[model samples]
Target chain A: MLTLFYILSAITLGTAFLTILSKNPIHSAIYLVLCFFSIAGHYLMFNAQFLFIVHIIVYSGAIMILMLFTIMLMNLNKADEKNKPILSRIAAVVAFCLVALVLLATFIKSQPVINEYKVSGQDFQSIKVLGQVLLNNYMVPFEFASVLLLVSMIGAVLLSKKEHINN
Target chain B: MDQAIIIEKGIFIVVIFAITMLFAMYETLAERKIAAWFQDRVGPNRAGKGGILQPLADGLKLFSKEEFFPNTENRFLFIAGPAISMTTALMTSAVIPWGDKLTLFGRDVILQATDINIGMLYVFGVLSVGVYGIMIGGWASNNKFSLMGAMRASSQMISYEVAMGLAIICLVMMTGTLSLGEIAAGQHGWRWNVLYQPVGFIIFLVCSFAETNRTPFDLAECEAELIGGYHTEYSSMKMGFYLFAEYASMFISSTILAVLYFGAYNYPGMDWVESVAGANIANIIGIFVLFAKICFFIFFYMWVRWTIPRFRYDQLMKLGWKMLIPLAIANIIVTGIIILLADQNL
Candidate 1:
């Protein structure tokens, strides 16, 4: 299990890096899809099958496809993004190093904790259990999310609608 | 897992893969033969007796054809498109319950690849990914026509999928299970879900027709408009992969429709048959029965393809978004009310 976790995490990190490093927007989108898939693989490794499927469906299937469509529609295939100014690049590097230092400092400070995993015998992540939790506990938030989505959809339709001019 | 179990699973996977390929191969021939019969003509009688070996000849011809790649920038994605399509097309068969368990060597063997708890959702997820195949292929081709076709295909699929999900929600509510095996098991004897959820079944059927890009909803590849559509630039085996993947998906969709709405492997007097003819024989019969249902669906696909003309793009969108989606939602609401009333009566 540990070995599988390491392998999946490596894949996830590798694809995530590639997603940004790829020049073409299409390639970046494909890499992002691969990254999402590897994350889904990680979910599967943790025995969260419902989350794994939902993650793949929402991320790799729907969201990535939409991203790809937008990329293709905009014809964003050229590797012509302008390089950042030297001062901004230097600042970016400094910021990255600062974040790395802070992360390392936190890791060192928390090093005494044992990294053992306890397997929960309960099928807490199963669809039935998840549905119960969502309906009973997270019902309001879930309904809000749905409402938010509906509003956005209506907003999109309204924005896309053409106006008529009377002669 | 034990070696024997591993070997059993390996054999099952191989058998399923082989059957999918074989059915896809013959579906091409069947499509031609059926089309010819409908047109009052003999189809491909030159390749062996009654064109039984036509698919083989076609395969050989396709293999020998030149592998032509267009002057496109994203070659990797161009190749990945058909590969993704073919892979996803074959993957959906894994969750389908081919038959009841067959007893062998003092052990019972379930005739399915893997009975995942979320079988239906898995199928839906994989199917949604199938859009990428066309989208990538068309985009990588750098052809405006191909891109347009891909756009239409993706949008149509996305639109129809909403209605399809709503339709399936009704089924899921009725069966109270996400597992296809459990659903099939619930439909014992002739107690098919279609008898109860007729509107849901119709909605699902229509959405499936749209989802599979068949006639009346095949706006993606309307040759009259898009010039062969998303596969306009593909040639040789690449083109063959796209076409074969369509047939494979068709076969898989038919199997899904059969397993979901139809009786799956169930038949009249199946229990009696099992009692009289022995479990093994009865299960074998059940497998054949499932294939028969699948074949009927395949034939139905072709029948519709030849009979119905392709829908205009606007009409397709209107049907998907306006007609099917509302109907599916209505079906779900009615199903929920009926279930609640039934519970109250009980």
Candidate 2:
């Protein structure tokens, strides 16, 4: 089980790094898809079947397809993209380090609490249990999340609509 | 798992793989024969009796054809395209309940590969992944037509998927389970889901056609404009994979339709049969009944392909988004209300 976890972690981290490192935007998108798939694999390993399938459906399936379509339509498969200016590159590096440091510090602070693995022997991750938890316990937050998504969807439609001068 | 169970499952999976492949192979022949019949032609009777060996001949021809590769940007992705498509096409069968349990050697053997809790969503997820196959293949070919086909396919699939998911949400609400095996077993002896959720069934049927890229919804590969579409630059076995994947998905989706709406492995007199002939014989018959339903759906797919003309791209999009999505949402709302009313006993 630990070995399997290690392997999946390797795939997740490797593909995520490749998503940034790949030159062509299409390749990067594909790598990001692989990364998402590996994360789904992790969910499956944790026996969160609902989360695993939903993650694949929403991220690897839908978001990645839209990303790939945009990349393909923009004809950005070429590897001849101009390098970012030195100042911007420096800013990116500094931002990356700061984020990494913050994450590491957070993990360290929470290390004692994360040490013990607990199995409650209660049904939690199955579709029924998850639905109950979401709809019953986290009802307000869940509805709010849906509302947020709906607003964003409306925003996307509005953004894509063409503005007619005559109209 | 026990060693015996492991062997049993392995053998079962192998049998299912073989069956799916064989069914897909024959589906191609069936499509052609049906199309020929529809067009008032005899079709290919040259291979075996009634062109029984036609698919084999086609397979041989594909294998012997020259494997041509365009000077594409990425050779790896070009090959990976059909591979992904074919793999995802076959993956959905894992959760399908082919038949009820059969006792053999004093052990009960479930005819399904695996009855995962979220079987329906697994099918949806894998199907959504199927778009990557066409997109990658089309983009890798580096042809304008192929890229355009890929874009059409991806958008069409994604759009239809929303409606399909919504339609299924209605069914899931009615059934109150995500497992296909349970859902199928629930429809024992004429309690089919379609009887209750006919509107949902219709929306799912249309969306399935769109999802599988069948005619009336096959704008992606409309040869009138895009030539061969995503497989425009593909040749030989690679091209065969694309075609085979389509037939395979058609077969699987037909099975899904049967399993979900039409009673899968169930007949009106199934209880009588079980009582009379014992569980083994009854279940064996049930398997055949399931296949019969599946075959009807497959025939229905071909029939629609032949009878209906392909939709224009705009019309297809309008139907998927403007029409089907709203209809499916309404179906869900109505189904929820009915369920709530039933629970309230008012």
Model 1 CA deviation exceeding 4 Å by range: A77-121, A162-167
Give a tens-digit lDDT track for model 2, residues B1-346.
Answer: 4998899999999998999999999998998899899999999899999999999999999999999999887999999999999999999999999999999988999999899999999999999999999999999998999999989988999999999999999888888899999999999898999999999999999999999999998888899899988999999999999999999999999999999999899989988988998989999999999999999999999998878888999999999989999998888888898999999996
Compare the candidates by lDDT and give the number of the best one: 2
Among all windows of ten consecutive residues in candidate 2 chain A, which has the lowest summed lDDT? A111-120
**Least well predicted 10-residue stretch by lDDT in candidate 2 chain B:** B167-176
Q: Output the lDDT of residue B62, model 2.
A: 100
Write down the worst ten-residue block by lDDT for model 1 chain B: B207-216
Q: Compared with the true structure, what per-residue lDDT tens digits does model 2 show for residues A1-167?
A: 99999998999999899988977888999999999998999999879899999999999999889988888897863565777899999999999999999999998887452123235555667778678778987999999999999999998877667454336
Candidate 1's residue-wise lDDT over A36-135, tens digit each? Answer: 9989998898688999999989998898999888988888535756778999999999999999999999988884312221244556767987798789
- Docking tier of model 2: it is high
lDDT of 2: 0.91
